[model samples]
Structure formats: structure tokens, C-alpha cells
Target: MQIKVDAEGDDAAAHDLYYWLRQDRELRRHAKADLTQAAEASDRMNAGEIINMFVSNGLAAASLLVNIVVAWRAARPSPQGTVTFDRDGTTVTVHDTSEETLRRVVDLLASAPPGGASGATDTGESSASSGSGNR
Candidate 1:
């Protein structure tokens, strides 16, 4: 037979089944013997075969972990701070000022347009707009 897993709802059940299967004495003995033989054979294996085996096992384990994590994440609802935006008519605005400075800048930017310029004077030093030439 075949086993089907409803990974989201039956994760605990699947783990219990796995434990039960692994606990079978005959199966465990066979597995242990196979592992011992493989270890001995691995000593005789060429460097390439040894490296390939190690890489394959590592990749398989990593793939399994990644799949489980992705499934678990998918099964749960996303929390706040995970922002979603529309494909159209949605704009992201970023300001790199401190909270107080950001608030003031936002207020200033909101009140005036680019070239109209507000807040600081033109001393040839960088103002926010002139620095980027957004004006």
C-alpha cells in the first residue's frame, strides 16, 4: 500500500504512523543491518561516490525540511505586518528620516510640491528634494 497525507490537518497522525512503522522490530533490525553494511561499503567507495552520497542525503533532508515548512506556513493564516498590495493603483512611499523627522518631512512634502520648496533654504548644501533632484 500507499499512504496519503493530508499534511495540514493530519501532521500528528502522520508522525504517529511513522513512529509506529519505525518501531517495528524486524524493520528496525533490517534497517540497522543495512546501515551497517552501507557504512562498510562507504569505506570502499571512491571519493566521488562518497561525496555524491553525502550531498544527495543532505539535499534530500533539506528538501524535506523546506517542503514541510512551506506547507505549514501555507496552512496558517498570515499575520499583520505582512503587507499585501494591489497590482494596480498601489504606491509604496519610503522616507529614511527618524520618526520625528519623517513626520515633519511628510507634513512638509504633503503641504507643497517639488520645485515649490519649503523648510530649509538654498545654501548649496543638500536639501531632501535637491539631493535627489526629484524636483
Candidate 2:
């Protein structure tokens, strides 16, 4: 599965997440993740950019990603904001990084599609962009 993570819709936040995920042992083991740069300056490292990840183990990989993201969100000084995880057709935007909230994300990603594949949501009272679309 391919995952695109955007942090608070901010490029810097996305880059922050990219570097953070890079350092995660479990995440590194599960997926090959990288930061997406501008079309013009692809050589230089883009600090504030989206993160793209490819995983072979589907839900397990997504779960590891969310776990790392939740920890990263908590470690921030303040204003945790939100992070959106888009995989397949499911979009989960998280405001509160609680266990329950993160679980919802995992559930959505793991959900069975009409056929045999598709996916998962957040625990936040702010329900705006989280969608369980067909994968």
C-alpha cells in the first residue's frame, strides 16, 4: 500500500514527519519512506513537504506509521494540530493522538472493501475530512 501523510496541511510539518519516520527503526523495517520534494528542486532536501511511503504488510505497516506519528505529535512542544493519512481511498485526519483515535485510523485502513481490498478515522470530536472511501 502507498501512504501519503500531510501534517496540518503544512509543508514543514510534513517534512518534520518525514525525518521523524526515517529515524524510526520499526517504520524503516516495515516500509521504504521518503519525502516528496518540489518538481523543480528535486535534488535538495525539502524540509516542508509531504511524505510518501510504500509498505508490503498493509495494515501492520499503516499501524506502525500511525504509532510513530502519534508519538511525534505528543512530543511536540504544543499546538499538536492535526495530521492526515491518505491511503488507497481512505483519508483519516487526526486531531487528538489518543489510542482510541489512532485505533480508528487503523480500523479504517483495515476495513474490507466491496470486494476483497479497501480500508479506516479519528477519535477527534472535529469530524470534517476523515472519510472511509473505497480503496
Candidate 3:
């Protein structure tokens, strides 16, 4: 997956925020665990056998359901624009689109709090990240 962040604020603050996100150990650990589990699950799926007609139909149905769910999520409407962060009474919204920025945002959000944001919150703007299975 990829992450994209855009911030409207001081260059130094944005860079520092990104750095802090990268150094967060919990985020890194969770991201590693998630990737590992996905890899393991992918490895365990064995698609070589079609035991009988019923089994084949069941597999096909399951695949269809999975595809449908993915499609539904893709079609769902989500908030658009940059994630806003409030630091020391200053509101900073992230909008960076660089590869490194994406990686950092992904890693940070992977293990962020349920709200997808942390730290200062006073601007009433959401500086949240998006992900699941985070601790």
C-alpha cells in the first residue's frame, strides 16, 4: 500500500513531524506484523485442487464475495483533501505526495490510535490516519 500526506505549514515542522512518525516504534512494529500476517496468509492459500462440483462452486462463490466486498469498499465515499493536524494552537494539514512522505504516513497510520491521529488537538480539524488492525 501507499500513503500520501499534504501539510500546509512551516517546512521545518512538517519535516520534523514526518521524522517523528518514522521513529515511532509502535507504528513500525504493527506495520511489520500486519505485512507478515498478510504474507503468511497468502502463502497458505492453496488453489491447486477442485475436489468436486460443490467445492468448486463454493470456491467460486467465495471469490465472488471477496471481490464484491473489495468493490464496495472502493466505491464507498471517504473524506477528501489533506489530513489536518493541530500543534501548539497552529493547524497544519498534510498534503505531501512524495514517495517518502507516503511511506512515512502509511507507517504512522498503521499503528496509530483508533482516531487515526495523535498529539495536539485544538483546531477542530482531523489529523487522522486511516487503517485497520492497529493496536
Candidates in descending TM-score order: 2, 3, 1
In order of listing, the candidates' clash counts read 0, 3, 10
- Report lDDT per candidate: 0.25, 0.60, 0.29
Q: Which candidate would rank higher by lDDT, 1 or 3?
A: 3
lDDT of 1 at 28: 42
Model 3 bad stretches (over 4 Å): 32-81, 84-135
- Tens digits of per-residue lDDT for model 2, 72-127: 87777646666655655556667676555678777755555324544423323323
In candidate 1, position 18 carries an lDDT of 38
lDDT of 3 by residue, 32-74 (tens): 2111111221211221111111111123332332232223323
Q: Would you list the clashing residue pairs of candidate 2? A: 11-48, 108-120, 109-120
Model 2: residues with Cα > 4 Å off, grouped in runs = 1-11, 37-48, 111-135
Give the candidate number with the greatest TM-score. 2
- lDDT tens digits, residue span 81-112, model 1: 11011111221121122244233323332332
RMSD (Cα, Å) for all candidates, in order, is 25.8, 8.0, 21.2
**Can you rank all candidates by lDDT, best first?**
2, 3, 1
TM-score on alpha carbons, each prediction: 0.19, 0.64, 0.22
